[model samples]
Target: MNAIFLMLMGLGAMALGYFVYSKFICEKIFKVDPHFRTPAHEMQDGIDYVPTNKYILWGHHFTSVAGAAPIIGPAIAVIWGWVPAFLWVVFGTIFFAGVHDAGAIWASARNKAKSIGSLTGDIVGNRARSIFMIVIFLVLLMVNAVFAVVISGQLINFPSATLPVWGAIIVALIIGQLIYRKIIGLLLVTIIGVVALYAMIYAGPMIPLALPDSIAGFSARQSWIVILFAYAAIASLLPVWMLLQPRDYINGIQLFIGLILVYGAVLISGPEIVAPAFNNELPEGTPSMIPLLFVTIACGAISGFHGLVSSGTTSKQLDKEPDVRFVGYFGAVGEGSLALAAIIAATAGFASLADWQAIYHSFGQGGVSAFINGGANILQQGIGLDTVLAQTLLTVMVVLFAGTTMDTGLRLQRYIFQEWGHIYNVGWMQKAAPATFLAVGSCLLLAFGAGGDGAGGMLIWPLFGTTNQLLAGLTLLVITVMLVKKRRPMWYTLGPLIFLLVMTTLALLTQLKSFYDKGDWFLFTLDLVVLAAAILVSLECTATLTKQIKANKASPATDQP
Candidate 1:
């Protein structure tokens, strides 16, 4: 089969979902109240709460939620073949991810732009809010750890990526000063930034900046990890407009160009689909598709992390409540489109059937790396680019994705710490400097101390998928709670929520056997804690649902905002 067919099919489905199904959702379910004043206008702080153009906010939200996870997920998941991963990416985004993301934004916007953590109290109870907040902390911890490892790995292992990665940051800073200071139109800045980013990709190999084996006695990887966290610390501490929003705008442009490049390659090259529709032969320790596929492909298909970005940050920056549909739903479709690009590159962009199989065979070392190699092949074969430069281009893209995600994760973690301190009345913990240290310190410990020699960030990666999916399940449950509060029918959110809960729970349960067999008590214990947290959050969600149903039965429906 020609790869173009699958690419067009995926794009067609997304367009249909956006126009048809997403319209039904907007009209019947999350009715937008244009008359309502948004928090961005009400609380115009010009920092976190400033009103932003829908396009710009959409860029910010999409870039942050995307990162490397979507690429990493579907890139690895094609191990099951393109069929399952492709199907999930299509329907899953249309129904689950788009709804969850839009619902999160709507739910938070309706409640004075509160974080989803704060909105939990209104549905479950006040205490459940605290519980979910702690869950957010864990989510942030995993994010920071995983991305730090990913970026450093790119720096150390793929030295060609380093120049383009850091070069884009400098480019973003220039664009920031130009646009934010009103020196140039955003359209002109965007064009220049995108071109400059690609230029850097071409220029990257000319000045590869690989770290040495020892930096003040630390190993290269270890030294890179410390440097990454330091960069994340400063990025997180800075105001949104200063660095993050501007940088993400540049990334937002890169992502679309990437989609064009990868998909454009499909149209040009028309590579054959040699990988099976569903590979039944199981590799040792490879997860069954039953629950693992869903977890592995969270960001593109469905993710709880989107909820935090939507409610915690995006809601506070909305220019209008009506724009929620565009920013939230379209942002999700944008992510799914990116995932589709990855699926195409992995399944159809391979040099040969034997080459694809060889890459998947070394899954541990190159699951993520395959995307870089395959993407390079696509660029080389279709776009007439040099193979080495093409490889460097993708490596830099991945590093940039990971870098932005790391910055956003640390920022969210800092928010959780400050929120925890204020809600619990811990005076000293409310300060940004202390909270930044503590937040970065914990991630450091997880990435280094407990990770020991593996201190590269793999310590938490084994079950990070399960925990992240659990967070997605919880996010959907929270969306359900928000709907019920408004006397809205919630089958759309409820169905996906239940499905995610079951799959993630089952995935964790299945993984425990290996944890025990390996005598890895550390992971074994952590798994149990996450499992318990899922159970508790589910109970709270269930209780809220029951109470809502009973109240409606006993009296007339009391509609809420």
Candidate 2:
């Protein structure tokens, strides 16, 4: 297929899903009542359950939904060609992600401001609640660790790109704070901020702070992991308004602009999709397409991680009843569209199928920088631009995308640590200082481990997919339990849960085989860690369901007395 056809197909699929399937079918079946008194309305707390405006909530929800996972997963999925990735993303978002995200918001709203963890306890049982918390905590840890490495690698690969993106973030935060909170002039602040950000982009190469020969040996990828951890530590401790919120606002704008540029390029160049549809065989020693494709494109289609963000943060800030559908369900569709855009962009650029295969073989696993440079060179040839500068800018854009996600991950880790400490009655963790320190320490350990090899290649990538899918499976389980409790038709939740369990379990087994085959003791060890966690969580969930069933049966008789 050509780029134009693919783009049209993608947008059509999204529009059909979002407007028709989501609005007419799912809403009618699920009976989503916007006027129902949500938790934010019933229990109005300024801190957590405050009702927010739709526009501001959109900013928050979109930022949280769009993260590094979406980019990386789709990028990897395209290795199998844009066809599978594109189909999964479009269909998955329509059926699974939209449902999951919307369900999280609805569940939270019904539960009177309780988080997903707390809701699990009330509906699934206390045991399942504990298990859910542990799963989420580990998921956040892995997320923070992986993203830190991703950003650090980008920074090192393209120093020229880093300065402007970073500068944009810094400027955005200051301007956002001054305009929104400090009551400064919004129009002037925005204008000045945009101009400054653009200026930094042009001036980035002229800046003098290049990596030294000795430090440069650290490898751009490895250094990023450390830098990511350090940045996370600070971000976790700051007031959300000061850093996290404002920074995301800025990053959101950049994301918008970057995406527009990419789409414009696609339209201008009209590159054909050169990757084959179902090339005769899979990559060497690969698993069959059935489970692997689903597993590979986990984030693009339907991510359980989205549930965590929805229930943990976004749901908490939902100010009104109607906003739930837009921010939760629609936001997911937006993310799916972004992933689709990436898949199209990657597949569409090459001159011919042979050229595409050659490029993929040479630099596919080298990371995003290589892909961007390769794509930039293609664009330079076809569309006359300074190849070096375009590639540098592309690198910076990728890094900034990864960096924003890392910041969110770090903040989440702090919350997870604090909550875990509180649940266990750990005195030290009850204090902010101790919790922050613990979060930082945990991230640092992962960073160091990920960076152990000089190349930082193939070290963290393998772990990211399995752990991510497992988290998604766990999220589905929680959502299923909630659906059952709400007395919705059980099939909606049961069907997806069963499908996810099979896919994720198979994916984990695949990882185990690969680990054993490679004889890499460290990865083998990590595999064992993940397997144990999965088993424990499953048992906890089973036990909780059994108890709930028995309780429901006994309740009717006791009421007769």
Among these predictions, the greatest TM-score belongs to 1
Candidate number achieving the greatest lDDT relative to the actual structure: 1
In model 2, state the lDDT of residue 109: 69
lDDT of the candidates, in the order given: 0.83, 0.66
**TM-score, every prediction:** 0.96, 0.87
Model 2 per-residue lDDT tens digits across residues 18-59: 777667434644566666776656766554455655655655
Superposed Cα deviation of residue 363, candidate 1 (Å): 5.6
TM-score of predicted structure 1: 0.96
